[model samples]
Target chain A: MKRAELIFQSIALITLAVAFILFWNFGKGVSFAENGLPSGPTVTDSYVVLQENLNRMIPILLGSILLSVAIAFYLEEYLARTGWKYQIIARQIIILASIPSLLYGLLGLYFFVFQSKKGSFFIHALTVVLLVMPRTIQSTQMAIRSVDISIREAAFALGAKRWRVIIDHVFPHAFSVIMSGIFTVISRALAIAALIIVVYVWTKHTLQSGDTFYIPGSAIVLLLSSLLSSVLSSFLEAKTNWD
Target chain B: MQSQKTDPILHIHDLNVWYGKSQILKNLTFDVLPRQVTAFIGPSNSGKTTLVRCLNRLNDLNVNFRYTGKILYKDENLYAPQLKAAKIAQQIGMVFQKPIPFRKSIYENVAYSARLRGIKQSDQLDTIVEESLRKAQLWDEVYKHLHTSSDALSNGQQQRLCIARALAGDPEILIFDEPCEQLDAAETPKLEAIVQNLKSHYTLIFVTNKRRQAARVSDVAGFLYNGELVEFGQTEQIFTNPIDKRTENYVTGRL
Candidate 1:
């Protein structure tokens, strides 16, 4: 590994270890005295909160990745190749990505929760997908575009079809860059619970005051996942390096 | 070889190519004889690359690219509405100015073309890979490191590996678009030798600006000046005898 990469891994490891320790010691229940000493164990659904967050976050993260990557591929490979105005589309995506997250929350609340009348879980998850997709699409498009055009031409000259060029050659060349972009999106998706609060409010399931472990528990989970994603993307980037 | 030379493998007739209203190649025509090296020599941006790319339809990827031409391969229309680029590419392969080995192992880089044609048996792939490498004149050096990444190879070896990759597809005709442009003096002769050796098996179209390289390698030579085919004939005649003033000037290094 390079020196910078080793340093980055070390910092990430230290941060994760500290976060884990902090969560383990104080993330069980709300127990405190006037002097801030541990009084006693209290009633807190810490495990339930953790489970609920995972159940909500995983699918949305996966959905965002799948949907955005597909959209980005179509835009770059097909539409862009057919002479579409990609710069305008990319600019529009950047504008959408920069819009406030709460606006997406409200949009989701009005559409999925109000018009469709779906369950809160589905609504919230889909809303998070909507919130994170713009940035992911932008980044994914950049990754796909960053692939060397010569490689694609070389593949085409080898009797491979357009789809084959994309699937077998282009995707592998761009996979590491794509994963790095997706990892950034994943981190964004995990921290987007604040957006879910809008739908949670309407669904009559809001964060309780005494459930103190929920916030810290979610934070540690986010940290750990981000670190894991970093490592995985780095490994993939190394594995796929051709030069 | 004499039997193969009886008929031209590729016939480009009255070809004109344009990209977004800017004409690149204008009214160009030529015949590429089978199992021989036909070199197109020209200055930069004279549409030499464009003409080569038109053979396998690689220019189709450009959205604004437009062309009016009839490219006949073995008496069949290459630009027929039903003939897909993939199908043309299978019979007519291309190597670019820069060597672009796929981001794969040396073995996989060569085998990838075969795998695309659904050659799934490992033993078959190994045999094809070895044969291609040997044909590219690279098997002796790289046979031991078949599974290693192609990144470890020198630029010359990488270019040869690309040749092996193209040959693995069993193309009858191979296009070399400035294959020696990126190679050093030491490496150029090696590639030149490979091209000379390959003429017995595959129809070769070589594009280069180096006049002597063209003189040394081509069986037939065509000079392009501003996308026009100034001359096309035997290499020795084109080099030494009377022809178009432009062709004479180009060959003698005056223009």
Candidate 2:
């Protein structure tokens, strides 16, 4: 292998080792007494409530992904051109991103959830969508910007109009980067959904795990699974493209 | 010098280009005739590349980069504020010193513009790609593997692919900015041949520092020094019997 490659590998391995050490020694810190373990699972009314939360969480995850993809497409294609509209759109995106996720949930509650008078599941999902949309827009914009200017110019000089340049040149060149950003937003939204549920949980009273096995920790498990899946999928996808 | 009798196809009159408060090109004036290769030669920081970019309005990409002058393409003024840079770019394509191929298949690179012009039929796109590659002298090597990624090609091939991408638009004028600077010595002459062959169909404007290579390819030559046009005339006259002292010094390596 090249010396540079070897050095990079060594650095990555060392960083991973350090991270593992920190996680094992400093991160996990729960202790148990008497039985020398945590409390065993309980069969109580809360199990059904957790199931309901899981059910509500699943749709929120899906909605976040769908919403992020839509926002990504718009930022990558429509808002990238040079004009007053581009500047205004970019500024609006920045302002939107700066708003906290809880604020977005509040806004969604006012707009979609409260007005529609639907179940908490739809409200939670819509809130998650609003929370994740701005991040996706920003990531997609960055990915599009990273495309080489020469490639875009070359396409335009050849006869490509504005839309053609984005679809044929900019989009293809930025596909991997944009997909990775989408994955990042999906993971982030999954984590945020758990927090949103905690905030709005008082109103719903019980969590809804969709037509599946229900447990007290289902909400936490669902959040963990979604986060894990997005991260793993992004890694595999990036690895496949790297070759 | 052919008695200076022929009417130039493209002319730059008193071109003064500035980047915000800093001036880059100073009162530049020159003319290029049709079906001829004109080379701009100068040392680094001499505004050779800037002058060529100004011709295509690419210099305007920088918000602060402004200019005071008129660039005439077929005697039509290009700097008319109302004219879109994209339209000007369609009329005059550019190839940079570095080979920049979009991370896509060779066929896609060639067909991108055709598709943009609303040609969706596969057969029409295939013909255009083939013709463009043939013009760029890249078809034989890339014919079978046109679907392969363009970055997989050799550096020289990638450079030719960029040229093919430029040609696919069928522009009237072509600008090359030190196109062979990144290539090895062995690849220089092949690039020169491509430039020479292209001059037959398009008005070619090139920027180069290699004196012999400039002499080998250009019909007319302009020497720029310190952001000013030092001399402009036929290639042979500028190389062999330059009138200006600065031009003579530049040609003889005395400067």
Among all candidates shown, the one with the greatest TM-score: 1
**Deviation from native of the Cα of residue A66 in model 1, angstroms:** 0.9
The per-prediction i-RMS, to one decimal, reads 1.0, 2.7
How far off is residue B214 in model 2, in Å?
1.0
Stretches of candidate 2 exceeding 4 Å from the true structure: A1-126, A198-243, B1-6, B81-83, B117-124
- Which ten-residue region of model 2 chain B has the weakest summed lDDT? B1-10
- List pairs with backbone clashes in candidate 2: A51-A208, A51-A209, A52-A207, A52-A208, A52-A209, A53-A207, A53-A208, A55-A208, A55-A209, A55-A210
lDDT of 2 by residue, B49-115 (tens): 8888887777655666787877888778888777877778877888898898877799998786666
Per lDDT, the best of the predicted structures is 1
Alpha carbon lDDT of each predicted model: 0.82, 0.75
Given candidate 1, what's the lDDT at residue B241? 95
